[model samples]
Target: MATVHNNSLNRLSAGGLLISLGIIFGDIGTSPLYVFKAIFNQGTVTPDLVIGAISCVFWTLTLQTTIKYVLITLNADNKGEGGILSLYSLVRRRAKWLIIPAIVGASTLLADGMITPAITISSAVEGLAIHNPAFPTVPVVVLIISLLFVIQRFGTSIVGRVFGPLMLVWFSTIGILGFAYIDKAPEVIKALNPYYAIHTIVHYPNALFIIGAIFLCTTGAEALYSDMGHCGKSNIRVSWIFVKLCLILNYFGQGAWLITHQGNVLGENNPFYAIMPDWFLFYGIIIATVAAIIASQAMISGSYTLISEAVRLNIWPKVTIRYPSDQKGQLYVPSINLILFIGCMLIIFVFRKSSNMEAAYGLAINLTFLSTTILVIYFMLRKRIHKLWIVLFALIYFTVEITFLVGNGVKIGHGGWLTLLLALTIFIVMYAWYTARKIKNRHVKFDDIKKYYPIISELSEDETVPTFASQLVYLTSANNKEEIETKVIYSILNKKPKRADVYWIVHVDVMDTPHARDYTVNQLIPGKLIRIDFKLGFREEQKISLLLRKVIEDMVSKGEIDITSQYKTLKKYHIPGDFNFVVLEKVFTKTSELNWPERIVMELYKILKNFSLSEEKGFGLDSSFVTLERVPLNIPNTGNLQLRRVK
Candidate 1:
């Protein structure tokens, strides 16, 4: 599997890699805005504290970001796909224990998706105040958010194209600024050493005021794993080498600028913008704003993809999925967009400034980062990828990450609770949905085709039902007996006697991997009605219509079902008559026999059924040729009695 997967490394192109870097690296790229400012503002630190803090940031990026993410997590990709859900899908069977971490990581990622844009964009907008203190922050923040929502409808391709160049400029600008400051305080360069990091922590005891402050440098490191499909592992690996170098240089420059000026302009607030010359402030604001928007774009795009993956895996409720491009992984989900919009607006309204939002920001990113670390450990152990190396690396990185998380955890009383609360809520809903779906599916008797076959066979003969009815297809579960029963009931109730013709219960099983084209079909119950079930491989995204067409063609070629029978008119040599679809909707009761949580989940699932793709579409039935007969079953109690039907 590793050898087969490694083949994708050859497919990475220069242009694609650059775009991936631009999109995937945006979060970490913009970290300089608040990371340094947060650390130096209120945190207790002696003169040597700068060196130690910078040392921790450097090493954290090396061990946590570069080593854990770029090296280890990226290797856990499921067929070139990476993300919390993707990782979960791959290892869920082998390392079921890791599912907890996967869920936490994914939930936190969603939380980051909501708060990142709010914080990043606000930080950039706050840069505007540098140009003109009179610039109203709240209105500008609202306007930028409104425009972001407006453009999301069109999709991000156009915006993505601009990201690369803008980020390039931002990096270059920071690089130049760092170099200018490096000329004056070259001694600050010593901070990159590990000794400095330890010295600052030990010598300057107060330096621990906000331990979570270091979280800024490593915030988006998870992107290395989350976006493996969009940007190949090698691309992120290579791009980060340069990105990290540039960032370190900039941080060092900021350190130098502060040391030389002795924090003269710091004024207990944003020294990031304050350090720059007045002439460059306007350009810096523009650059920062663009960087913020790009960071927000990455968050939005990543969230859409994550939710889409979740839906495919049945961890999330079915939502409308739109592919704006033929590009493999691109997707747009509307519900997520609206939710993010509301959350972001509220954050801006409440926080009002980027500095305040900082307290709330790192919580989600750190949580997500820690979750990924735990999963990566399991991933490595499962693959036998050097146990000692994996354990040692995970222990060191986890300790550092948890230390930062503690700081962010402290802010929970402030605004950090919002992210954690939202994450937990989403996690519960998603986990409940997945658990309920599994339990309901488990109880379903998929093999009961015997009970359904008779009904389907009878339906074929009924002249009163629909004159155009010829081809009858029942969508059933995998179990043969249950499918037969479902077929029989429909045939008996709808059709009169029974027509001599081909009938079958077709079951479509969706796979985890995308673009899965292969399937298996069974011809059970012989001539009158066949129970055909398709077991799709993980890589295939199942479409019932495509699979059915294939099944029909295969059967016709084998002389099992006549190819010449007219679908609309029954003829012995033609393909059998018009198609009729029968779908069995899962009925739920408030007082179901299942546990309370399961019952509640089923109720929600029932509501969601209405919004799911119609049976006609799901079963590959043509709009003009399909008729639906919905069967409602009673919710069983201790006694079997038909109560008044409730709508």
Candidate 2:
């Protein structure tokens, strides 16, 4: 068995710009499809409204996406990786209370993935309605989304290659189309000035509500920031120059078109498609649909990555993850895919048209952005930046994002509650899981291994005891190599007096780095007792069966303990020794005492525990050779008289 797992993210190159184009820009790239329509949907199209909205869109992208995420937050990388969790890893030790925001941010990001595909793709598909107002796009949207989810099991390794070029074409064509319409309403360019954004907020009626629609322009910036590791900060930063230009150019062109029409009410025709020339209409619609599909795929993949990281951190229940494409960080989670599919389908059915989804769109992501802002501020503080500068950064971002949150808050009555509910559910689960872990840790007691060493060695050679196997391996949670769990000691010496030629303890330590993998071995007792500690990155998967075999092979090469079967007949034939793994499964014992908070959290943890992957499966151990032992959680003391013989 070979033991190598490298999750090195796709790094920078000439093509790096393209992969960044395809992956990083998916959610934001497709924003042009519905942003203008959303702006016009809430009210009439007038000069102040149009210009003010475009100005808001311009600066929002600049300050939020450009200044905050691209320029500043991108600097907060963990081993070239960037995300809410990755960001938290930088400052978690500095402030333990910070985990709450990280949890909320990750939860909201997960919620955003479910709605992003529904809204972005639906908006593009809805473009066909311009040609024939009667076109039913819901069914088409459903089919496209369904197909996207269906293919996830196979992995995105093969299809991911083309994502970059297709996105480049997407940005280029849309940029040109927007440019073509610029001359028609050149005056809209004045809207880029900040005064218009402020003036609209100061004077426009129900301006805050309308700002909700403007907020759509920068929703993808968060997702882009999360995907930084895939293409590296350099690639993303470089690509965004072109990508931002294209986005801004197209946005200005749409503004130009809206200003030219100058009707009291903009009709059902979308400004995104309306800007397209009659000759290019068919091609434009096709291109838009394809871009939407790519964006949807990126969102689905991001969701999988988010949950996978959460599982590694124990903030989420463990679930089976598959490497469909084996392209570095690419992964497929069947359960998450199904959940997102159902959620997307439900949104499609409930909202029906892309127009109705605007209210539901930006609500949850605002929380995500706000959460990231909080985390980033703390992260900057830890870097020992000047207090004055940190204050300024926090003030600027909080003002921008808090305003967006307020704007998006108005959407709640209309449809925002849907995403909020989903986000809340996810947040509770994460918080509960994380909190329960802290509770469980408080009760975990480890005993020094020195006292048990002699006993373990004696048992290894006990002739009267039955041999469990040639080797007995135990997976331990004890962080110190010099310590062992009492339950494991009980199983070995007192429970059954089982024996083996050698005892091995394996401890896996999940590291903060994204792709790290290394192991250290300690021989507490030469030829009889050994410990192997595996240090794995959060992004890497664990396959103990294969890894253990590799360890054994290496040890044999170094002339460590032999693994040959001891029986003379088998030894003569050169048969390999048998290895047995013992797993300790914990359950909350009724004998334990706890407060309401602890009890509730533990019970919820237990309920969620059932949904998680089994210990053997999660560790990637071969279950056939594994025997699970149920151990009661720490219990309160029973008085000595309780054991007295009854008269």
Candidate 3:
């Protein structure tokens, strides 16, 4: 499936290019609305300052977006999928500590999701102030954002159809608007020179802060790489040429306008709008708002995909995932949507203006870029590329990303702390969930299943014992084919002696590749005892009930096993036996000993578990035939008791 998809992606068409414009470039494509506004806000505008900032924007897009991501990082895809997690999956086995970078990158990317909508929408709406100066944009911005998030449950198929065309109009409009002013001050073209970029960094006032503002130009570059799987590498690469050209035209146009009014502080007038004629101002504002909403929608959808992958990878707790439409990969996560909505609302109420939100933006995403650089280095190493090329790659990207990180770091005191705090909170949750699972698995005791086969077989044939069901199924975590968890055995024999006609154990293994699905069966005791191992890709859904039924149908068709009722009366009619599923739910007991850090981790994990989906729901099992079994994790140690029993 992945191969076919990638092959199709390689063949580009007009529709593919349009979809790329809509989905892949929405974030960065909307940057012109605020990138110049942000840079000019730093200090007074001058010819040198204007030229240097535009130069920095040009090179930043080239190095960060074009070279690093489009050329290099996109090649690290995992089964035709691209993202930080997809990249991590390709090289996770090489180093266990790589999880740290993955967690940090993923968490920060989410933070970017929340802040992007706030800034983009606010910036677009702020344009209304030009006409009346007293027009309240906050309420309008809030209303637009609220509406965008509210419609998520209904799916974006209808609105999504127009995204590509609308964005096409948007890019063309901005390109024309920017091109109009370039001839007025044709000297602005010199900003494309690298010497000006160096001059601005060396001699400009508050150069780090200026670089931070420049960082916003390519903030959506990460999204460009992430959406690679959606519209094929060919489409994105081809469409980016036009997108980049439009963006540079707009930036240089803004620079031209600034140079004409050099040494003047830009207060109430925004260069993005000033470049437009007064007659087109109203329509331009409308276009900008629509573009902002489209950008926000893209971010919201990407957030859902990100959280879904995290849950499947076990780095995030399982949450309720809803398929709002039949469109592939169109999912709505209620919990995430609510969280992001509230975050955006809070940012609007607090910051109250796009300029204020700008300080909070770019900081978290800078960390994400840094994390990607680190992960990509390891990816290059695993591919067995020459070490010299690896070192050079490391030196260039590491230096560039680290410089951006430091630049954005200055925003920490000014509204940037909000995003940093949000990222930190998300990181804690991911760490606690991942580490707690490790701690729990460390003490899990597995018993060899061969020893239990005799008793299981005997119980299946015992006439004295009442049959619990015709078939009994248990979900196991044991990776070894010959071993099963002791808790599973306890549930079968010691807990209540669950007698049945046949016993089945099923194990699910999440593979490193995306979209893989295959299963194998091991018949330990022929028809009486069977084990099924399912290998599913990280992106695949875990619908065990449906999968189990299909596996049984295959086995029955091949004459490998009989699923017909063993009861004499039902057997005569050839009726299928009812199967009962038992799902083991682990709970921490008070008897378990742990250090302070471990205890803190467990406490956090418990809190997160309370909000997560139940084991049955997470695995997509039917609740009607499923039973929940609470098993104590880290079984009590009697030897460590301090008091002796009274005689």
Provide TM-scores for the models.
0.87, 0.96, 0.98
> Candidate 1 or 3, higher lDDT?
3
Tens digits of per-residue lDDT, candidate 1, 1-647, equal: 00111334426666655666578788888888888777776644344666677787888788878877887678887767888777777667776567678778888898888888888888778877764778898888889877987677666676667777788888878777776777677788787678987766666655444467777788888876777776677777777777887888888887776676663434335656755778998889889888888888888888887877776677777666666665455567788888888888878877888777777887877877777777667777778888789878777877787777776777788788888887888787677677776776655533344555556556555556543335566676655434444334444455434343456567666555544555555555556666666765333344566668787888778877653444344455454454555556554433355778777777776666666666565444566655555443433554787578778
Q: How high is the CA lDDT of each candidate model?
A: 0.70, 0.85, 0.89
Tens-digit per-residue lDDT, 1-647, candidate 2: 00011233245567777778888998899999988888788577887788888899999999999999899999899987788988887788887898898998998988888899899888888878876888888899999999999988977776777888899999999899888889998888898789999999989878778788888988899877778777778888889999999998999899888888786587577889888889988898899888988888888888888888888888998899988654567788999999899989988888998888987889898888988989888888888889998999999989888888898989999889999988898998898889888887777678999998888888887888888888889999999889998888888887788688888999998887877779999999887889999998888888988888899899999998688877678889989778999998866676247788878888888888888899999999999999899986676566654665778
Q: Candidate 2: minimum summed lDDT over ten consecutive residues — where?
A: 1-10
Which lDDT tens digits does candidate 3 get at residues 614-639?
99999999999898999998767788
Question: Which residue segments of model 1 deviate by more than 4 Å?
Answer: 1-13, 43-46, 95-97, 202-209, 263-269, 446-468, 479-500, 525-542, 550-560, 563-576, 590-592, 599-634, 637-647
Instruction: Sort every candidate by lDDT, greatest first.
Output: 3, 2, 1
Clashing residue pairs in candidate 2 are none
Ranked by TM-score from best down, the candidates are: 3, 2, 1
Single out the weakest 10-residue window by summed lDDT for candidate 1: 1-10
Among these predicted structures, which one has the highest lDDT? 3
